[model samples]
Target: MRAVMNAILNVVLPVFGIMLAGYLVGRARILGEDSGRALNGFVYYVALPALFFGSMADVPLARIFNWPLILSFGGGLLVTFLFSIAVALVFFRGRFGEVSMHGLTAIFSNTGYMGVPLLQIAFGQQGVLAAVITTVITAVVVIGIGVILLETDRHQGSAPRVIARNVSLGLAKNPLILSALAGILYSWSGLPLPQPVATFMELTGNAAAPAALFAIGLFMVGKSLTEGMREVVWISSLKLLVAPLVTAWLAYSVLGMQGVDAKAAIIQAALPTGALMFVLAQQYGVYVQRATSVILVSTVLSVLTLSALFVLLGVQ
Candidate 1:
């Protein structure tokens, strides 16, 4: 019991404290409303990429390509995603765009911002490696499917080939994905990073955790649980509860993932819905209120859920 309490205090509080500071700052209007956007841009375009690249650059190809971790995490996400779609269709009578967004909200764990930082704090660089792998999976597979579905819904008569091409191009241009791949390639070459470059990456990457968490709090400032309370509860359950359970089962029982790989996969699965889903909701003007509610509610509730999970996973 004492160990559990310590884990909560030592790991969870600090992460959420930074986020709360950001939220308070935003609420006070100390900075412009766009402050979150700017911070997120820095994290996304600069800090996160550097972190991913730097982490992956030194890892061996064998460790980096852990198939069990990949399959377990990816399978869990796919299952949750498909289940969310079914719920959307049957319960909400949602169309393609709305269902796609719903699925995204359920499966899109905030791996980039919250997951990376939390894992780094709890388990260090090994945890971060697991996070980077999951981030890539979410960015590439989950986001790709969501975008394709939304685009197809929006452009009913457009050519399938064009939509596929556009989505491919967008994913190709994603900085996180590009950086991870680049790091893998560099690692494959088996060349050490020069002192200057390594120093630069370390300095820049160090900023990613705090900046990303603060950005989440800032982004969350104005959102509230205004409408779609039932749907909000449903999707939040999937994201915060069911997803993690499924991932845990797969990682431990089915896929034989042990140690940090299993723990990180489960933790990442339990993360609150990513803010990117809200961005996509706003952009497509589909399920906007529900998306906002899911993000906000899930984030607040995750404080308890994640704390319990840390205890269960024996994270210290």
Candidate 2:
């Protein structure tokens, strides 16, 4: 019992401590909104990409694929993606674009920011491999589908070719996706990350977590979490509860994943919704308020749920 509490303290405190610092910083208004954007740009375009690239560089090609783990994580993510769409359609009476937006918010975990740091804190650098893979998958699968739905609507009545072109363009422009691809290609080619290049990436990648957590804090400040209670509760519940359970079951039963690998899949599945989903919502101008509300609620609840989960899995 003492050990469990210790594990929680060791794992949870530092992670949330950084977040608290970010929140306090935001509350103090030491920096303006533009500073927050610059921090986010560093995280998304620079730090996260370097992290993913280094994670994959020179690792065995087979290890990177890690089929059982991938199956468990990807299957769980896909199920939640579909589940959110159904809920939006039936309960919310949402339109096509709104449904797509809902699906994005529900399925896309905060893998790049929270997942990387949380897993590293819990399981050390070895754990980051799964986090990186999960982030890459989210980029390709979630964002790809989002672009399809969003572009399809904008180009309503146009040929499929136009939509495809737009999707390709968007994917090309995303540093996260391109970095993952580069990492995989480098691994496949059996090339080593050169010493100087590796050092540069490591230095930059180390900044990803703190910057991301702090920026999340900055973004949370001045936002009204008051209005979207009903939708927020519903979405957060599914993201925190249902998604992790499904991933664990699939990992054990369907994928035959056990031990540390199974735990990794489940943890990654249970992360709070990514703020990138909020970016998508803002882009489409649909369900922005509810999306914002869902992220905060999910993040707060995940502390309890994730702590219990680690104990159950004996990961702590």
Kindly list the per-residue Cα lDDT of model 2 for residues 16-70, writing each as its tens digit: 6776787788888888767767777777778878976876675667765878888
Q: Give the TM-score of each candidate.
A: 0.76, 0.80
Error of 2 at 64 (Å): 1.7
Candidate 1, residues 81-144, lDDT tens digits: the string is 8898887888987767888888889988878767877788788899888988887778656765
CA lDDT, candidate 2, residue 26: 84
The C-alpha local distance difference test score for the whole of candidate 2 amounts to: 0.74
lDDT of the structure predicted as candidate 1: 0.79
| Candidate no. 1 TM-score | 0.76
Name the best candidate (by lDDT): 1
Best by TM-score: 2
